[model samples]
Target: MTNFFDQFMSPTYLGVPLMALALTLPWVLYPTPSSRWLNNRLLTLQAWFINRFTQQLLLPLNTGGHKWAVMFTSLMLFLLTINLMGLLPYTFTPTTQLSLNMGLAVPLWLATVIIGMRNQPTIALGHLLPEGTPPLLVPILIIIETISLFIRPLALGVRLTANLTAGHLLIQLIATAVFVLMSTMPTVAIITATVLFLLTLLEVAVAMIQAYVFVLLLSLYLQENV
Candidate 1:
């Protein structure tokens, strides 16, 4: 029903317009930097994760690109938190909105392209055409490559929006089926509920993976530019 899709819509709270609280909640929840020889398990675990992720993400990039390490890592954390939080009852996922996703994608994608053009114009332009191309196909290839280059941010935005929207719809449908069948077919309802539980677990994994992928692709873009 239309009501199922309505859950994804943004809701206003009181008189103030609020987007996903999950966007800011993670930062508030994070512990402040402390000065000590030893730290708690949670802080240690968080540190290990950030350090490991940063190392792997930056490994392929030149030293020039390392400057963005903090920004990208923060983006990854913000996305991961927003996505995971959306799985909770009564929460909205901002990433499910194409506009929000595009807003994130376009600026960052454009920045990379700009950097490439500014710092290495020849290399950036070189990406448009292959080393050896037939004269007859030159215009066609250039047009194709240009279109593809422009589509990167669009692809990024749509990919995130589609995946999250699909997963949420599936979860809602399954949950509704379980609820509707509970009295008529108890056993079937139980099975459906079990499947819903499993799907929730899968959705959790998808949330994390998608967030990682989003950031990973951005890093690759940066790698090309820097």
Candidate 2:
């Protein structure tokens, strides 16, 4: 049987890497802002969207955290673009790979933790143990909190990877069923095809939301530290 999971593999052309091309494709999709007085529809829409998204993302952060405005917004747009692109037929979704997600998650998360440690070491270390804890459970709570702290990045990466992976797998399974049932069961195949169309729409929404959620959670972590 063909492995359903093979869809997630990075595409290659003559043994050369195409993952880099897939990863960079999102940047080219955006229309560059021109120096003219009037703006095109695409540029106007892009600017408006970025402005609104930036405002919402930074609403919870303090002034200090505002420094991350550019990085966070850019990250959101990149993820959003790549995700939607993946929904297209014969395209690879880089975010579906755990390595890419973790690579993004760990460093960003570590930066937040480092900011906390550098700016206010006392408060950062105090996060391990809560105020007014009973003496007996103090050590246990410390251990538990420490474990939880370390697992944040893992949680972030796994959440993104699993969501996209499951969606893509369901899409493939249903698509395969539609093809298989077409000749033998025309009526059922039609129904399956309709279901596939609906699922595709849902996956598009999932793509956008998961990207936002990934960035949102990072912002929340930043809020705590800053």
Candidate 3:
């Protein structure tokens, strides 16, 4: 209400933690399967989508990596839910906050690196130095690789935050222009509204894609360690 940035800030009511509520709200939207032999169309479709997504996501992973299925699935659904829900009117998007995104990225990324180090320290540490490097460049290459490794989490959080924030800002700006020009420039207002609609659709696709990419990247990190 105060400014455009206000919309992206974590919402609060009185003293309640609305961000937690938003995070959990997506679970309520999903339906639970019944014990009966037959399933409803919604349940069937949901199951099918999740199944196919999981299969595809894990395709490149080893059997050892299969242990992460539940985590990966839950995370994917959580992210996908919050992202889509955030697109709705009068709702807050938790993923757009760099703090929240980094909270997720750091832990998951650390887990992958830890797994690699524990299971195969030789190979894990080896990532910091590529194979067959010239004797003179080993230290420089190690430093570069180490920096790159640490940058992964920062990149993940920033990427998600920046994408969602930019999309939201663009939509808000266009919608504002549409309102401001409606009386004096009816034709232009209509054109702006149309652009807003198309942009909204693109943002929706972006929401889905970003969620998948976040999980996909995590899976890839796990793959290296496994």
Task: Tell how far residue 93 is off in model 2, in angstroms.
Answer: 0.7
Off by over 4 Å in 1: none
- Tens-place lDDT digits, model 1, residues 52-121: 9999999999998999999899999988988898999978898999999999999999999999999999
Models ranked on lDDT:
2, 3, 1
lDDT of 2 by residue, 1-226 (tens): 2899999988889999798999988898888999999998989998999999999999989999999999999999999999999999888999999999999999999999999999988989999999999999999999999999999999999999999999999999999999999999999999999999999999999999999999999999999888
Candidate 3: misplaced stretches above 4 Å?
none
TM-score of each: 0.96, 0.97, 0.97
Could you give candidate 3's per-residue lDDT for residues 1-226 as a string of tens digits?
6698989977789978698888778889899988988899999998899899889999999999999988999899999889988899998999999999999999999999999999999999988988899999999999999999999999999999999999999999999999999999999999999999999999999999999999999999999999
lDDT of each: 0.91, 0.95, 0.93
Best model per lDDT? 2
- Which 10 consecutive positions of candidate 1 have the poorest summed lDDT? 15-24
What is candidate 2's local distance difference test score? 0.95
Each prediction's RMSD to truth? 1.3, 1.1, 1.0
